[model samples]
Target chain A: MAAQLKGARVALEVDNVTKRFGGLTALDHVSFKVYEGEILGLIGPNGAGKTTMFNVITGVYKPEEGRVIYYGEDITGLKPHVIARKGIARTHQVVKPFNELTVLENAMIGALFGTRHGQITEEEARSIAMEILEFVGLAEKAEEPAKVLNIQEKKRLELARALAEEPRLLLLDEVLAGLNPTEVAHMLDLLRKIRREKGVTMIMIEHVMHAVMNLADRIVVLHFGRKLAEGTPEEVARNPEVIAAYLGDPELALKFVRRLGGV
Target chain B: MNDTIRKLYTRPSALIAWGLVLIFVVVGVLFKAGLVSLNTATIAMDLMVNIGLALSLAIIMSYAGYVSFGHAVFYGLGGFLTGYIVYNAVQTAYTANPQNFNLTFGRALGWWLEGAVLGALASAALAGTVGAAVLRLRGAFFAIATIGLDYAVLYLVKLYHNPLSGSADIPVTQLGAIEGFFYKTYVLVTVFFIVTVIVAYLARVSKFGYGLSAIREDEDAAEVLGVDTTRYKVYAFILSAVLTSLWGSITVWRQNSFGVDIMFSLRESVHMIAMNVIGGLGSFLGPTLGGMVYYALYRATLTKLANSQFIVVGIIVILFISLLPEGLVGLVKLVRPKLRKYID
Candidate 1:
């Protein structure tokens, strides 16, 4: 990835963010900083509030306590579109594509209105969308209806649409969750390339440790809506608490360790 | 095949459509020539009114994924408002005991045109107001709210039977020349048709249209993508309502009166839904095609076999939903590709 940190500043700063849904606390005083041009992996077991954290960051759900500061501005509780305009974009856990619209048309919407008062000619938006599609290896499927895409392709299209917005901070929720090995490898390469080419900061909520460990500069783990650990991939993998948590599933932990390859 | 023929044959159904319109025009012209005093032209006019209703429904159904059964309320209100204005104008003109309510070319043109304009404005206002409240509901709730509104309006119209201001029938002593009256009605219908076409076109092309389609496809996703769902829904409802009201006003003008029976009838609501479905809900040309076909069938078959007309219509609607959910246009799309392969 390109390390051209021109005007390199904090891309996102979440100061004690908390979210509660009825009786269940989805997030509890979560705090993190995403540096410009860095990939941050957020991982936890199921019901660990990883997706909820993403929702709060992307303005889908407002944090009950604390603020979400993006690029030095307090953007807490802004509508999703308003936050999107401020250069924060996100993909959903369950891929949501406009089914009736062609893939290109869906991406075009992102390019046209992604930023606040940002206007681009239709031709320009189309070219940008096409380029993003190529980056995601979906150039061939640009004219097809988004509904007809396979799961992997739909996930890629969601990412491509977010990229079209030229977001400085991109929040990706479980993008590699359902992908096959080859598809997962391709997505990892694409994320690396995106960070290199666009200098976009990304916070990825991932279940696949191998995919995220290799990509994220820093890794944060959560359990029951509270921060469990935050450190380099090597430190996190060796943490006794993390190992005990994964001990119940010996197969997954063994596989993760093997994939880490002596890290 | 040359470009024109290739384009024409590419859409075989469209070609058949043009052929049908041509046949209707020929029949209308022949009837006007006195070979037949066929009431088909009047029926065709009514079909055009139904087309307007279907077109409005299409905006909600196809574009917004909202199904409304109470659109008849707007249609009836439109007709009633138009009837109220034109009838009052005629009464004003004849109170001085003019020989005929019909004005000469020089005077009648301006007065009739003014009445048409006023009627359109009134209908549009009412539609916008009602659309605001009713559009907030979705799914069955939205549909029921609209139906409730329709019944409410029907009862309100029923309650008022005053001869001068609120009654269903307002007789005009001096209705201008027959030629001028028919000509004005034709103009109003044409204007409403053009407006419907323009609204459909805009909805198909504009950002607002895309937003509406996105909402229809997935509301939560659209919101996450920064689309304001509520605002777009209201806009779609108002625009659809205005077009429907324009059609309603013209219907009232044609009858020179309005009543609860005509405005809020359940049959009228069914006609609107049927027109949209038979035409191809959501497709731009669906409502128009459905309206024309249904009207023709109603005139040719229903008029002769009055009771069975509805049964036949019911059967056709059932077939459309079960056999061809995409409606007539969908059927054409299925056939055209196969036919082209054979030709090739």
Candidate 2:
């Protein structure tokens, strides 16, 4: 994973972006480039503007300053669906499934929309949806109502839906949240497979440290609505500022860094 | 050949829906042909009209997931407009021969049919214009807005005291034999009901219908998934209004009178909601089943309590909402899970 997609062309770029919600600034002058086919981990403490950054990239929020460039095309202030149709897919932190519909139908919606084949017929969408569900190991549960699925299954359903779009860039928001240890390990393995086999560029926001450190080739840390640090996961784990962002006390920051295997 | 036909049976709900439609048409035709009593035909016509009305309202509400409390606005508008058109035709006859009392009942069906068409068109146009604005609000807000709209139309029509205007509430002249009137109305409403079923099923199985269901589930999420939620909703509203208006046109044609009170009454709207709710919201057979039960209630007891009839309707709807929120169809599916595929 580290050797592959090294020095690849930029798939997505956020240059000098700032987002403000009335009195509070959610993201200020945040900039990063996600290389094509690379797993980019975005780690931050609570209220560190991590999800807000995902919203901006996914077109749910338009930055007050700076532009979002995808493959050299400047896409600023476009509607979320428009951006989605241009091959960007995202999962919500809280999984949302169409409760009345079957899992297949839920996935079929993603395949039918938010992609180049936005005008495809329902039959065409079904084939694509089934293929995605099969890949996500949810083919057996295709006929069941989405609401019948538990939380972990719902999370996988969300991933399958996002995958159904066959997005060029996938924004995964806390895919590992609330999972048991085995579920987390299973998800981490799936992420590795997604990177290796699917080759979809990913930007994952996760509080689960090992999952991010294991899956991401490079990690970016956000703190107080700004890009605090950026490097390989090993380098980021050793950064004093990144440690301080995690734990405010300077002494605690040093202890945390040492615990992370920093000298 | 069998595979081709089997392909059409993809949704069991649609197949069952068409089956029910065929049964109604056959029974309706048999009655018209005197194979059954006139009493049966009248009951069938009433059921067909209510089914059409409930299906239209429920389909829109189900897809959009909003209860339209003022559905009778379209029904009333369609009825009054058709009545006015039919009245104008009779007035011309009276002017030509003041002594004869407009005996153009044979020609009157044509004029009535024309009026029905225009009435449906007018109602749908209103929905398009109003839905664009009112449909923006969701849930209770949309319901309240539609109620306000129904009353506003009613009051505005009431202000017109001119005999030529819609507010005058003119009693339509008798045209042709009573049998002819019954046949024309029965056939006319039957055609509309058939068209309503076709449209409802098409909307359910098509890509557009899928978009609507997505919107019903979660509007914001649907938008993120690339659904043009606003456009789908407005189109559903327009289609629903057009179908309901056709039934309204049939209502005035049967009653032989039109007024704001009779046509645009809030009580009428409440009845429509009750029928749809009792049947099932969003289910293919829900509206049909609901309309039948509702008309049956009218025949069984509501007719006795004419003034306070809505109290019974109110109670029945409340009971259904509490005990069987998905209505009869939902209960059926729960009892026989194997039948869920064919019915739900």
Give the top-scoring candidate (DockQ).
2
User: How far off is each candidate at the interface, as Cα RMSD in Å?
Assistant: 6.7, 3.6
C-alpha positional error of residue A69 in candidate 1 after TM-score superposition, expressed in Å: 2.3
Report, for every candidate in turn, its global Cα lDDT versus the true structure: 0.72, 0.80
Flag regions of model 2 displaced more than 4 Å: A1-7, A116-119, A247-263, B1-10, B97-106, B164-167, B175-179
Per-prediction DockQ: 0.37, 0.51
Worst 10 residues of 2 chain B by lDDT: B1-10
Superposed by TM-score, candidate 1 places the C-alpha of residue B338 at a distance from the truth, in angstroms, of 10
Q: What is the TM-score, restricted to chain A, for candidate 2? A: 0.92
- Report clash pairs, candidate 2: none
Q: How large is the interface RMSD of candidate 1? A: 6.7
Q: Which candidate tops lDDT?
A: 2
Model 2 docking tier (incorrect/acceptable/medium/high): medium
